[model samples]
Target: MPEDAPERVEGHTTRRVLVTGAASGLGAALTAAFRARGDEVLATDVVSTPLDHRDGPVEHREHDVLRLDVTSDDDWAAALATVEERWGGLDILVNNAGVAGGGRIDVAGLDEWEWITGINLFGVVRGCRTFVPMLKRQRSGQIVNVASLAGLVHPAGMASYNAVKAGVVALTETLGHELAPYDVGASVVCPSYFRTNLMDSLRGADEALGGVVTALVETSPFTADEIAAAVLAGLDAGEEVILPDPAARAAWELKQTDRAAYVDQMRRQAARLDQLA
Candidate 1:
């Protein structure tokens, strides 16, 4: 970005932000980043872990997406009511909650796939279902759904996660178009790697599958702060899609040019990864 670009982009400031999955990692980083910029941030996550950061204007809370299940209309209604009571009107919402499902689509149990998609995909859907109305009432707001580079270009061994994130990307894209009438912007963030407890947070249908995913995460290399910065940039620029890393953008470009070729290339890469393993 140009020296003045950030300043120009951030010319306007947001009053309030609600970030899901804020117990740690990118969610935690985002809470601090937004608060540092003078926004009142309400960060929530399923875990009841203590939020130890003290660098900004942040209010932390425990939020279980399962409790706020998007699949449940009543739950969505209640959660929205609670959010309305706390902030009056929410200016921005970052749907950053997700889980990793193993790549073995064919062999992965149906229950495991369902569990992951419910959290990773339907989680975002529920957020939109619950919050979009309020945002519309406010007439100006932003919804940032945290997808993955997998959403843009799937690699082998992440079938469920890839599918859900791809759904998030598609949903947010359509949402952006739908929200334009209300002057509300929707953005889908596709990030690669990102150092986070994502490995530890895996909620598989069983223990053995969880172990497989945990091993893979040990090799991923993306920083939470970097991804947070990318998210902030997307919000500031009013971008419809945010690719948090250069490699993610490159991968996306490759997929766009030749999707079949991209899949074959990823298969080769996976073979190399297996060799390393």
Candidate 2:
């Protein structure tokens, strides 16, 4: 363990978790998981309303979502205030609000780059900046940043998306060290494609590449709830980097153990993407 690793608490202690992008997908799954474990969750999203999924309305529960645009500092501040007023201080901060975009480096426009970065990367930054001080003051908290497999094992035709997710990975790692002395822990969740409405936020100059990603997401055997369960288990085990799926674990292991084979596979994928484009 690292020198700054926080000591694990014993026994069941209810935590107050604030999850962004909790309107649906992995975020909603996380919210539900924590609540099921007898923790309090303040779910926030770009929309403040009753939670609804693609399948149907969320089952009637005492669910109230706050409106929080992660890109906005004012919104983040408001969230902090609300947390203080309601929960005294937050125990876990889940920076999971992100949009997806991918294309060839030359094909993706700067506008597309900015839009995705604002939500995917900087959104997490803003959340940390706003809440880290409070966490440090209290000397206890955890941060979970939701990244993607692209962050760890980058393929082709996703330059912007890869860069931002990789940034999240770097940020989370750095925080793990920086906040360790304060009795705080940080984890980065890098799950591969699963059945999620993440495609709803997909935007790219290359429509074909978008379609390819959509298919991968739609066809994945894993579900958001499954991924959420894995995340909680990883946290329980004091893991800093959580690879929630077997594919993610395998790809990361391949990259770590055999550089030559990983490079060859990435090259092959790039060539295939070129053919599709």
**CA RMSD for every model?**
5.9, 6.0
Where model 2 places Cα greater than 4 Å from the true spot, the runs are 1-11, 52-54, 59-63
What TM-score does model 2 achieve against the real structure?
0.93
Best by lDDT: 2
Clash statistics: count for each candidate: 4, 0
Q: For model 1, where is the 10-residue window of minimal lDDT?
A: 1-10
Question: Residue-wise lDDT of candidate 1 within 1-277, one digit each (tens)?
Answer: 3332212225556477878777677787887777667676766666555342322334442332223334556765776777778768988888987766664555578887888888888888888988898899889999999998888787666678889999999999999999899999999999876567777656554445455556545566657777887788887787788998887888889889988889899889667545544
Task: Write one digit per residue (lDDT tens) for candidate 2, span 108-178.
Answer: 99999999999999999999998999999999999999999999999888999999999999999999999
Error of 2 at 232 (Å): 0.3
State the lDDT at 120 in candidate 1.
88
